[model samples]
Target: MKALLLAGGLGTRLRPLTENLPKPMALVGNKPWLEHLIVHLKQQGIGDFVLAVKHYADVIKKRLGDGSSLGVRIEYAIEEDLLGTAGAIKNAEDLLSDRFLVVNSDIIHEISIIPLLEFHRNHNGLVTIGLTEVEDPSQYGVVELDMSGRILRFVEKPNKHEAPSRFINAGIYVMEKEALQWIPKHKEVSIERETFPLLIEKNIGVYGKTINGYWMDMGTKNRYRQLHWDLLDGKFTLPLKEKEQGKGIWLGRNTEIGPGVLLVPPVLIGDEVHIGERSVIGPYAVIGDHCELGRHVRCSETIMWDKCKVHDSTQLNNCIFGYGLEVGSRHILHEAVMNRAVGVIQG
Candidate 1:
C-alpha cells in the first residue's frame, strides 16, 4: 500500500528548534523524527510513499533519498504554495490510485499501522480515521462515532461546555481513492474543516479506528523533551533498547571517560563521547555524538546533541543544548532550549 505523508507544515509552535528545522526533522533521540515514521511504515508492508512538502522540502529530500535505504520507494509532491492537508492530497491525486494511508509528519508514536489497515479492510469504509481519547476535546477536532464505529459527526474544536466526545482526531487516516473526488484542486482545504463534515452529511462510509499505543505530538519544546524521556523510559516498542535502569550508564562505541567520574543511571552517551575526570553525569542525561564534558561538570536531566562542549565546573539542569554548542567555563544552563542555527547562548 502507498502512504501519503504531510510534511510541509512550518513548525511555528516548536520555535528555536523549528527555526532551523521542519517539524518532521526535529531530533527525538539520535535521529530525525521522521526517520522513526519511515522505518515504522516500512515494517508494516507499506513500501511506496509520497511526501507532500513545502517548507524546507529540499532538506527533507536530501536527507532521505528514494527511501532505498529503508526499502521503500519515495516520491515527492512539492507545493510552491501553502496548501491545506486535503488540498495537498488532492494535488497528489494522480499518485494515489487505490486505498492509501495519510498521516501528519509531526506525530510521534509506536506507529503500529496494521490494526488500522485491518480495520479499514474489514469495514470496507471509504475512509477509516485513527482516533485517540484526550482529556480535553475542546482544543481538538473531535470525532463522534456510533457503536458500529461509523463516524456520526466531525466537530471542530468545540467549547468545553459543548463538546460531544473526548475522542479527537489522531491525524492518521486510511483513505480510498473515491474520497479524493470530494477534494477540490489547488485550494485551501482541511480534512476536518471541509471534507469530513461533507462526507458525514452525505452519508459516506466514514469509520473510526481507536488506537491503543504510545502517541504524542511533538509540536512544542516541552513535548519534545518529554518524548526523549519517555523513550529512555521505554514508552514505545522498538529495536533500540533503553539502557537498564540503575545500570550506571552505557556509553556508545569508542567513548572515552576519565577516572573518578560519577556516572548515574538512565544516561546515554552517544558514540565517541568524551568525559573528563570528576564529572557528575545524570540519571536522565542524553549526550549525543562527539560531546566533550570537562572536569567537575555537573549535569542532570539534560540533553546535549552532537559536538557540544561543556567546560569545567559548568552545570546543566533540565536543559536542551543543540548541536555544535560550546559552553563557557562555569556556565550554568537550566530549563533552557538552544537552537542550533540561532547561535544564541542561554544561561
Candidate 2:
C-alpha cells in the first residue's frame, strides 16, 4: 500500500530542538526518528512512501534523498504553506493509491497493519482509523464503536465523567482514495475536526480498529526524553541498535574512556568520544559523536549532541545539549536545554 505520511508539522512545542529541525527530524537514539517510522512501515509490506512535508522540507529532502538508502522508493509532496492534517493528505491527492495509509509522523507505534487492512477491506469503509485504549481519554478525541467496529461517535476532550470510551484515535488511518473527495484543497483543514465528523454525519462506512501495542506521541520535549529512556530501559526495541561496549552501554567507534572513569550501564556514547579520568557517566547519558568529557565530570540523564565538550568538574543531570557545546569547568546544570549550533567554550 502507498502511504502518505504527514511529515510537516512545525513542532512548536519542541522549541529549541525544532528551532533547527522539523518534528520528524528530531533525533532519537542518535538517529532521525522519522527513519525509524519509515523502517517500521516498510516492514509491513508497504514500500512506496509519500512524505507530505512543509516545514523544513529541504532538510528532510537533503537527509533522506529519494529514500534509496533504506531500500524503499520515496516521493516528497512539498507544501508551500502549513497544511492541516487532512489538507496535507488532500495536497498529496495525486500520489495516493486507490487504498492508502495515512499516518501522522509525530507518533511511534508497535501496531501491525495486516489486521487493520483486513478490517478495512472487509468493511469496505471510506476510512478505518486505528484506535488505542488510553487511561485518560479526557485529553484526546475518544472513539465509540458499535459491535461491528463502526465508529458511533467522537467526543473531543470530554471530561473523565462524560467520556463514553477509553479508546482514542491513534493517528493512523487506512483510507480509500475516494475519501479525498470529502476534503477541500488549497486550504487548512483538519481531518479530525472537520472531515471525519462529516463522514459520520453522512453515515458513511467509517470504522475503527483497536490496536493493542506500544504507541506514543513524540511531540513534546518530555515525550522525546521518555522515548530515549524507554528504549534504554528495554521497554521497546528500535530498528537500529548501537554498538555495545557492555550490556546496556552502547559505545561508538574510537571512543576512549580514561582511567578511573566510572560508567553506569544504559549509556550511549557516540564515535570518537574521549572521557577523562574520574568522570562518571550514564544511567541514561547520551554522548554524541566527537564529544569530550574532562576529569571529574559527572553526567546522568543527559543527551549531548555531536562535538560537545564538558570540562573538568562539570556535573549535568536531566539536560539536553545541542551541537558543538564546550561546557566550562565546575559548572552544574539540571533540567537544562541548550541549542547552540556553533562550537564555543562556555565558562
Best by TM-score: 2
| Candidate 1, 1-347: lDDT as tens digits | 78999999999877766776678987667677787788888887888999998998888989988999878899999888887999999988888759889999899888688899889999857999999988888988988889989999978889977888889889899999999899988898988889988898899889998988888888877887788788777776544422433554656777887898888877878888889999999878888888899999999998887889889999989988777888889888788788777656443
Runs of candidate 1 exceeding 4 Å displacement:
159-162, 241-248, 345-347
The weakest ten consecutive residues by lDDT in model 2 span: 338-347
What TM-score would you give candidate 1 relative to the actual structure? 0.93
Task: Assess the local accuracy of residue 44 in candidate 2 as a C-alpha lDDT between 0 and 100.
Answer: 85
Find the 10 residues in a row with the least total lDDT in model 1. Answer: 237-246
Error of 2 at 208 (Å): 0.9
After best superposition, candidate 2 residue 156: deviation in angstroms? 0.8
Stretches of candidate 2 above 4 Å error?
A: 342-347
- Local distance difference test, candidate 2: 0.87
| Cα-lDDT of candidate 1 | 0.84
Question: Candidate 2, residue 137: CA error in Å?
Answer: 1.3
| Whole-model lDDT values for every prediction | 0.84, 0.87
